[model samples]
Target: MDPAAGLTDVRAASPTTGDDLVTLDGVAKTYTTATGTTQALSPTSLAIRRGEFLSVVGPSGCGKSTLLTMISGLVPPTAGEVRIDGELVDRPYRHCGIAFQTSVLLEWRSVLDNVLLQFEMRGIDPAPHRDKAVALLDSLGLEGSSRLYPRELSGGMKQRVSIARALIHDPSLLLMDEPFSAVDALTRDQLSMDLQQVCMDRGRDLTVLFITHHIEEAVFLGDRVLVMTPRPGRIAEVIDIDLPRPRRLEDAGREKQAAYAAHIRETFSRVGVYRRNQHEGGQA
Candidate 1:
């Protein structure tokens, strides 16, 4: 069967709140690299409902990151348009938060201070969110380390701090590019669970567009998984995760997750697409 045929209209499967929170209509992206012009994303369309955790996966350099940046308004599309909540997106929106493969904490700053950096950058007062930030850290099992510098923390702790920072502003949309890629397997699992809980607790619907190379992780976390093709990428398929909600890592239902993951791997193989750096082992 055609992979595209496998996709169900995401909205049809789940009732959305009013209008879509994010819409990509015939969007495309091109880059003028040293090697010359490169088309990263082909014309594509997608709609993200409010409070949904959506993951995009494809062969590396297939504009996965480009798509993330385009939605975040960090990079302009070469063609077509991007809109958030019916408003055209021409620049980064204040109601957004982002985290990447690395923790990206300021090396000189203490963990608590780094967590507060986002508020300072936006010129927003951190006092109101300070308790929330502290609570986030404590829940992540990093309460005392808040006073320590990023350099003094372990890789997992640093990522925990990064996650805390991203949530400080209460962004309605979170764009994450492999945020847990640097941590160990155990820590990564813990972070995934923690993130789900965080989203559940927050109001105003946290719409997340997460990019990853790990099929299993994508299946495990995303409400819908958008798989993409190779260079000049186009969305290949959108797989709905029908597993029962509130999933934990060690649940017996994990076997079902493995089966869904197998479907992704098989689908990728059928399309002759693979991750850019297999050795990296981390998601995009």
Candidate 2:
């Protein structure tokens, strides 16, 4: 069976309901560098429905990361409003969870302790949420390593712990920025499967906004793929992943998966955005 079989089951059981959770209205972000003000993202609008897994993909420096940071309220947009469930997200919110490329776990904390750190910082009692933390670790296959430090775990394991921490708060929205990029191919697949089940088990009803450069990974996890253009990024296209839910790794869904990736690659090529980094000798 494909490692992602569990996510499919979750998708099947959770009949999609509810209204939009995150809505971006004419949102634009600009950075003022020494070189003068640069527009990272043009005015754009989009909505993320509750329980939807939305992935944003673009060529390097297309501002996919910028969009995520705005959603997380890390950076305020130069223009436009970012709303969560109709409330303007002008500052950090306690009901949100975030994870990124690095696990960002405290080196001094044990895996379980790291997962509980959020609660401690928020002045929440760890005792009450301890079981939830343990269960999250076990669900992600990190049960035996609860006492291990960040350095003691593998790249994939570290990422898993980060995920557990994000979900530990039981937040309504999950923001992930290239969370799986640091892991190997095999481990990435495994972790992706684990995430599918995690979201399903809680019926997280999460509005997940993920940033990824990998087309395949985006295709595998997202219900819709938002493609962007080069710097001064704007939404070039939004492609629906028509592949049926409950996708498997083998022939169960490979052909459809490949087609979606190919289509995205072709679109990138058409916009002259794919090979920009190789030619420019820089990371976008």
lDDT of 1 by residue, 1-284 (tens): 23335544433433444757988887998889899999999887788888888988888888999999999998889998998988999988778889999988999888888888888888978777777778878987797887899889889888888888887777889999989888998888888888877776773478888899878788878888888878878776788888766876775246778777777776776566854577866555
Candidate lDDT (C-alpha), each = 0.81, 0.80
Compute the lDDT of residue 138 as modeled in candidate 1. Answer: 93
Q: Give the poorly placed runs of model 2, Cα more than 4 Å off.
A: 1-18, 251-253, 276-284
Give stretches of model 1 more than 4 Å off.
Answer: 1-17, 251-254, 274-284
Considering every candidate listed, which one attains the maximal lDDT?
A: 1
- Single out the weakest 10-residue window by summed lDDT for candidate 2: 1-10
For residue 83, give model 2's deviation from the true position in Å: 0.5
